[model samples]
Target: MASSNMNIPSGYVSSASSPDWLNKGDNAWQMTAATVVALQSVPGLVILYGSIVKKKWAVNSAFMALYAFAAVWLCWVTWAFNMSFGEKLLPFWGKAKPALGQKFLIRQAELPATAHYHKGGSVVETAMSEPFFPMATMVYFQCVFAAITLILLAGSLLGRMNIRAWMLFVPLWLTFSYTVGCFSVWGGGFLFQWGVIDFCGGYVIHLSSGVAGFTAAYWVGPRSSKDRERFPPNNVLMTLTGAGLLWIGWAGFNGGGPYAANVVSSMAVLNTNICAATSLLVWTCLDVIFFKKPSVIGAVQGMITGLVCITPGAGLVQGWASIVMGILSGSIPWYTMMVVHKRSALLQKVDDTLGVIHTHAVAGFLGAALTGLFAEPTLCNLFLPVTNSRGGFYGGVGGYQFVKQIVGALFIIGWNVVATTIICLVIRLFVPLRMPEEELTIGDDAVHGEEAYALWGDGEKYDITKHGWLSDETNHDNNKVPSGVTQMV
Candidate 1:
C-alpha cells in the first residue's frame, strides 16, 4: 500500500504515490478477489452445468453460463452498474446511467449518499457501499455477481430452455429482478435502510436466483418425461471439479464483500469454509444413514447450500454458529429436497433441475433468518454502522432484526417471482421460452448443431462399431451412449 520504489521517471509522478486515496494492497486484493469470484461463474458453473446434465444437453447448459458472463459484463458497464449504485431514483432502485466514460471509471468509487431515505412521509437509515477502489474495479466486481446469479438460475432450465430465450432472459432478469435485489441489499435501497443484513449475498444472489429460477421453470415447463426420469450426470468427476472451484472460489466471494483486505474479510472467508465443510459432511452422513449409500450429487447440493447459508452471516456470526448454520443448511434442504419435494405438488410441479429451490432458496432464507439470531454486536459494528443491530442471542433489538430479515426476504421473493415471470412472458412473445419438441428430443445436437462430446475419429456419428451413439438414427432419450472422451481444454 505504500510507495517507495524507483520505477518512476525523473519528472513523472506514478499513481503509486501521487493519489493519497488509493491503497495499493487493498486495490490489488479487491481486483484479485473479483477475479476469483468470476472464475466461479465461467469455468466453474460452465463446467458444472455441462458435466451435471445428460450428454446431449451439455453444450447448451454450459453455453448459457458462458454467454451470460459476457452479456452481463457488457450490460453492466453500459448501465446496470449505475442502476445498482447510482443516485437513488426509486426507494428500491438507483437511477440508470452508463458507467463507461473514462472520467467516471478512473475516479475513486463511493457509496451512494448516506443521507436518510424517504417514503411518501418519513426518513430511514440506508445501507452504504464504501469500497476503496476506482469505479472500474467496483464495476467489475459487481458484474461478476450479476453474471453468476443468472448462471445459477440457469441450473433450473438447463435441459428445456430455448437458448435464444435464455440469452434474452439473462439481461431482462438482470435489469429488473437482479438490480432490484442488488439495490435493496447492497446498493443503499429500502431494505438496507431498514437494517436488513446480508453480509454478502445470501438474499440478493442465492434467494433471488432460487425464487426466480423456480418461477421461470414453472413458466417454461418441465423437461420431457423420459428426461425428467433419467437425466443422470454425464461426468461426476467433472461435476466434482466444478464443485471444488465453487467451494474454494467462495473465499473470494465473501472476502471481497467487505470491499477491503481487512479482518472482516478474513472472518468471512473462514466462516464460508467452515459452514460449507460442515454442511458437506452432515449431508454425506444423512445420505449414509437414510439411503444406506452416500450420493455425490447430494453432497454437492449440501456444499452449495452451506455456502449460501453462511453468506448472510459469514462475517457476522461466530465460528460455532457457522457450523450450526451448515448443519441446518445441509439437513433442512436435504429433507426438503428428499421428503417434502416428493410430497408437495407445488415442488413436484416445478422441475428445478439441480434442486436450486432447496439448496439456494430454502438455505438462503435460513441463513438470513439465522443471521438475525447469531450476529454479534461487535462484528456487526465492524461491517455496518447500524445501531443496535446485534442478533437475537445478543439480546437487544436483535429479535426485531429477525422479523426484518423475514420481511426483507418476503419482499425479495415477491419481487423476483413477479419480475422473472414478467421477463419470461415478454421474452415468450418474441421467442418461445422452451425448446420445440424436436429440439427437446434431440438436445444440444439439434439446438446448437454440436455436442459436448464427439468421437476422435468422425463427425456425423461416434463410429457405431466402437464408441456409442454412433448413428444419427439413434433415439436421443433412449440411447445409452458411452460418455465420450472429454474435450477438456
Candidate 2:
C-alpha cells in the first residue's frame, strides 16, 4: 500500500477525502506554470515570430503559431497525450488513447512504470511511483510540452509555407514523430531504461524541434528572392518583449520539471537564470568586439541559447557547472550561426526563419553533452536513488557519462532526421508545402487576411478604401478623389 502522507506533514493532518492545502497549492502552481509555458508559445512566440519575420510574412507566421496552439490542444486531449505517456506500446513508443474521460480526469495518479525510478534499490525492477495531482493536471502539463514542440517546428517552415499544409503537418507530426520521442525518453521507454538523464526536455523538445525544423526547412524550399534580400525584423521591441517572457517563463520551464516544489526545483530555477545571464553577457561582449556595436538581437539570441543549453542539466548540475555551460553555449552557437552558417552552403540554402537549427538544435545537443561532463552525484541523489559521481573533470567517472550523453543525443538527432524527412516527403506528395506564387507575392494579407500592425496613432483609425487608394467602389468618393490621393507624387 502507498503512504498517503508521502508529501504531507507528519504533525498536522487532514482527511483524505477532503482536499489538502498543500496538494491544492501544488496543483495551482503547476497549472500556473503550465499556463506560463503555453503563453510562451502563443502570444509570446507568436509575437516574437511576427516581429522577427519580414513584414510580409508576419501575419502568416503568427497565424501558423495560433493555428498550432489550437490544433495541438485538440490532438493532445483526444489522443496524442496518451500516445506519448500512456502504457508502452513498444520500447520506443506508447499506445495512443483518449484520456479526457471524466473518470480518467478525476483519478489521482503517479509516474508510470516507464518513468525514472530513483527510490528503490534495484534499478532493474523498481516499482513506479504515483503522483498526488489529479490525472487532469498531468494531462494538461504534458500537453503544453507537446504543443510547444510543434510550434518550434513551425520556425523552420515559416515565410512561404501554406497554412493548409501546416495544419495537416502539425497533427501528423505530433502523432508520428513527437509521440515516439516523448515516449522513448520520458514515458519510460528505452532511453529512460538506459539511464539517459534529461532533467527537462533537452532531447525530446529542443533537440527534436531543432532537427525537425532544419530538415523541414530543406524540404519546404526557401523563401522568395525578394523576401530574403531584405528580410528585416519589422518590430524589434516585440521580439524583446517575447524574449523577456521566455527568460522568466523558464522558471516554470525548468523548475516544474521535478513535478513538485522542492530543493531540485529551487536548484533548477537558480541554475537556469545563471546560465541565461552569463550567456547574454558573453554574447554581448563578443558582439561589441566583432561588430563595434552591441546588438540587442544578438543578446537575445545568446539568452535563448543559454536557456536551451542549460535546460537538459538544469536540475542535475551545480551552480558552478551552470556558468560553464552558459559560456560554452553562448560561444559555440555564436560561432556556428555567424562563422559556420555563413560559410556552409548547405545551411545557406535551407532557410530556417528563426535559426532554430543553431539556437535550439545545436545548443540543445551541446547542453546535453555538457550535462554528462558536469552532472553532480549530489544533485542526482536529490531526485533519483543513483549514487553521486563526479563528472569527467571531477575525476570520479572519467568518460562514461560523456559517452552516454553522446549516445542519447545521437539517438534523438538520427531518429528525428529520418522520421521528419519521411513525414515531410510524404506530406508534400499530397499537399503542397509552399504557398502559390501569386499568394507569396501579396504575402500575409492575400493568404491569412490579416496584418500584425495597424499603426493608427492616438486612437486614430484610417479607412484605406475611403481614400480611393483601392479599387473598391464602396470606399470610392462619389464627389471627388480623396484628399491624400493627389498629394502624393
Candidate 3:
C-alpha cells in the first residue's frame, strides 16, 4: 500500500507521497528555478530575437527559437538527456536510453558517473551528486538548460538559415555536439573528473553554443547583401523588454546550479546580478568614449558577456572577483565585436547574425580562465567535487586547475568546430543550407508565409506581387481574406 501523508514536515518520511529521499524545499526551488529558466527561452529570447533583427526577419528569428525550444524538449526526454547525464557510453558520451518511465522519474536525482577518486592511495572516494529531489525534477531542470543552449546557437544563424535545415539542424547538433560538451564538462566525463570548474554552464552551454553558432553561420553563408548593410532593429523597446527578462531569469539560471536552496545558491544569485550590472555599465561607458553616446544594443551585449563570464565560477568565487570578471567581460568582448571583427577577414566573411561568438564563446572562455585564477578554496569546498581545489591566486595545486580549465575549454572549442561543421554539411546533402535568393529578398513572408507586423494599408498581408510564396499561390493563407477586408495593393 502506498502512503499518502501530505502534511509531513522535514526529516525522512516513509510515505510514497513524501519519500524519505525528498527534500520539499529543494524540490520546490528546483521546479521554480527550472520554470524561470524555461521562460528565458520561450518569451525571453523569443522576443529578443524577434525585435533585434531587421523588420523582415522578425518572425523567422523568433520562430527559430520557439521551434528549437519545443524540439529540444521532445528529443531530450526521448534520448538526449540520458546521453548527457546517464550511464557512460564513452569517456565523453553517455548511453542513449529513454528517460520517461515512472520508475526512473521517482528515483532520487543522481549523477552516477560523477564520483571521483583521489590521486593518492588513501582509499578515499568522493561521492557522486545526489540532489535531494526526485529524478523528474532533475530531468526538467536539465531539459531547460539544453533547450536554451540550442536557442542561443540559433541566434547566430538567424536572418538567413533555411527553416527546413534549421529544423533538421537542432536535434542533430543537440545529439552530437551539445550532449558531448554537457557530459564532458558537467556529467562526470574527463573534464569533470580532472577538476574543471564550470560552476553553471560556461563551457557546456555558452562556449559550445558560441562556437557552434559561429561555425554554422560560416557554412550557411551570409544574409542577403542588402539587409546586411542596413539591418536596423524592428523594435528596440521590445528588445529591451526581452533583455530584462533574460537578466532577471538568470537568477534561476545560476541559482539552481547547486541543486539546493542553500548558501551556495544564494551566493550564486547575488554574483550573477552583480557581474551583469557591472558589465552593462562598463560596456555603456566604452560606447560613450568611442561612439560619443550610450548604445542600448552595446549595453545589452555587455550584460550578456558578463553573465557568460561569471557562469564558470558563479558560486565558487568571491563577489569582488565577479566585478573584476565583469570589467573584462564587458570590455574584451566589446573590443572583439566592435574592432577585431571588422579587421579579421574570416569574421567579416561570416555573418553571425547576433554576434553570439563574441558574447558567448569569448566571454565563456574568459570566464573559465578567470575562474581558474579566482575560485576561492573555501567556497570551492562547498560546491566542487574535488577536495582542496583552489584557483591559481591561492597557490598550491591551483595552477594545475588553471591548466585544466584551458584544456577543457580547448576541447569544447575543437569538438564544436568539428561537430557543427559536419552536422551542417550533412544537412546540406538533403536541403540547401540557406533559403533561396527570392526568399532571402522577401524575408519572413516568403519563408514562413507571414509578417511580424501588418501595419500598412488596411492591415492586409505582404504585397503578393512583391513577396508572394514561390511554391504555389493557392496555398497562401492570406489569399483567403475576409469577405469585406481589403487586400494590400
Candidate 4:
C-alpha cells in the first residue's frame, strides 16, 4: 500500500500531496474521464437527440438535455453533491451540504463513513483511501453522474413535454430523487453498510433514471400523431457521433467509480470496452441474421446495454466474465425490446420515447445480478474494507452478495417509482407536464422559437423563411426587382 502520514492536517495526507507518478497519473485519468462524460451529454447526446427526434422537435429535445446538463450542475454544487456524498441523512440518504468556496476546489477529500473507509496494513488504510484530488475533481466527477441521470430521465418525456415544465423538473428531481439513490447505494447508506456492491452505478444511475423516465413519460403523454408514425432521424451521422461518444465515455463512467487511478481502474476500463465491443458485435450479427442487414442504430443500442450491464462489476469481474455479460445484455435487451414490448399490453399504452426501460432499467438490473455471480476476491481485496468478499460462485462467499444485490436493486426501483410518481402528480396539480395540442403539432418552433436545422440552399435562405425574416442580401436583391414589377404576370 502507498504510504501516507496521517499526523498532518485533516485534509492534507502525504500520499495526496506526494509527487508520485501513480498519483498524478490517476488524477489525470480521473479528470479525463470526467471530461469524456461531459462530452457525452454536451455535443454528443445533444446532437443525437437533435437528429433522432422528429425534425420539428429536434431543438426542443436537444435543449432539454442541454438545460438539464446546466441545471444539474447548479444544484450539484449548491446542495445535491452533499446529499449524495455527505454525512448520513438517514438510512437511505445523507445530509445536505454546500460545495462552494475556493477551499473545495483545492483541498483533498475524506471518505465519508458511508464510503466504508477502514484502516488496513501499516499504511493506516481506510476503505478505499487515496490522497485526495482537489474538491473540484470530486464535485465535477459526481456532477457528471448526476447530470447524466437527469438527461436519461428526459428520454421518457421527450416530444410532448413542455419545455417550461421540464426546466422546472430537472433540479427538483435531482434533489428529491437522484440524491437518495446515490446516497443510499454509494454514499454509505444502509445498502452500502449491508455490503451491496455497485462498482459503478447500474442501480443508482441507470436503473433509477430508467424507471423515473418511463414514469414521467407516462404522465407527460405521447408525441403528436404525425411524429409517432413517421419520425425519422434527421441526421444519422450525428446519431453515430453521439453513439460513439457514449461508447468511449463509459470508460470514465465505470472506471472513475474507483475515484482513484489504480490497476482496478485500468481493469474496469478494459472490461467495459470488452463488453461493449462484444455486445455491439453480437447485436450486429443478430440484426443481420434476422433483418437481412445490420443496422448501425441497433448496434449502438446494443453497445449501450452492454456498457450498462458491465457497470456494476467493471472492476470486480474478469475479461471472460465481461464477455459473458455482454452477450447476455445484448441478447436479453434485444428480446425485451422486440418480443416483450410487443406482447405487453400495459407497455403499449405509454410511449417511452427512446426505450430507456429496456436499455437502462433491464440492463442495469441484470448487471447487478451478474455482479453477484462474477465479483472476484482479488479485486475485492484491492478495494479495502475487507468486508467486501467475492461473489457467490467464489468458494469463500455464499448467496449473501447476490441477496444484497437484489435488495439494493429493489430498493432503488421502489424509491424511484414512488418518489417520481409523487413528484409528477404534485407538479401536475399546478402545471401540466404536456404542452397544448397546437404547440405539440408545431413543435420546437412554437415552443422554443428555434429550429434544429435548415439544410436547404446554404441554410441561410431557409432560416430566413422559417423565422419570417429577410436578410440584408434579400432586401437589397429584392429592391433591384423594381417597384410594383409584374414580370411573371
In terms of lDDT, the best-performing candidate is 3
- Count of residue pairs whose backbone atoms collide, per candidate: 1, 5, 0, 6
Worst ten in a row by lDDT for model 3: 468-477
* Residue runs of model 1 more than 4 Å from their true location after superposition: 1-18, 114-128, 455-457, 462-489
116-153: candidate 2 lDDT, tens digit per residue: 44533355444454556677888888888888888888
Tens digits of lDDT, candidate 3, 39-74: 999899999999999887899999999999999999
TM-score of each: 0.91, 0.89, 0.93, 0.87
lDDT of every predicted structure (CA atoms): 0.87, 0.80, 0.91, 0.80
Q: Mark the regions of model 4 whose C-alpha exceeds 4 Å error after superposition.
A: 1-22, 115-131, 384-388, 456-489
Distance (Å) between predicted and true CA of 150, model 4? 0.7
Ten contiguous residues minimizing lDDT sum, candidate 1: 113-122
Which segments of model 2 are wrong by more than 4 Å?
1-22, 115-126, 385-390, 455-468, 471-489
Q: Which 10-residue span in candidate 4 carries the lowest summed lDDT?
A: 474-483
The candidate maximizing TM-score is 3
* Regions of model 3 farther than 4 Å from truth: 1-14, 120-124, 461-489
Q: Please give, for residues 389-425, the per-residue lDDT of candidate 1 as tens digits.
A: 7999888898898998999999999999999989989
> Cα lDDT of model 2 overall?
0.80
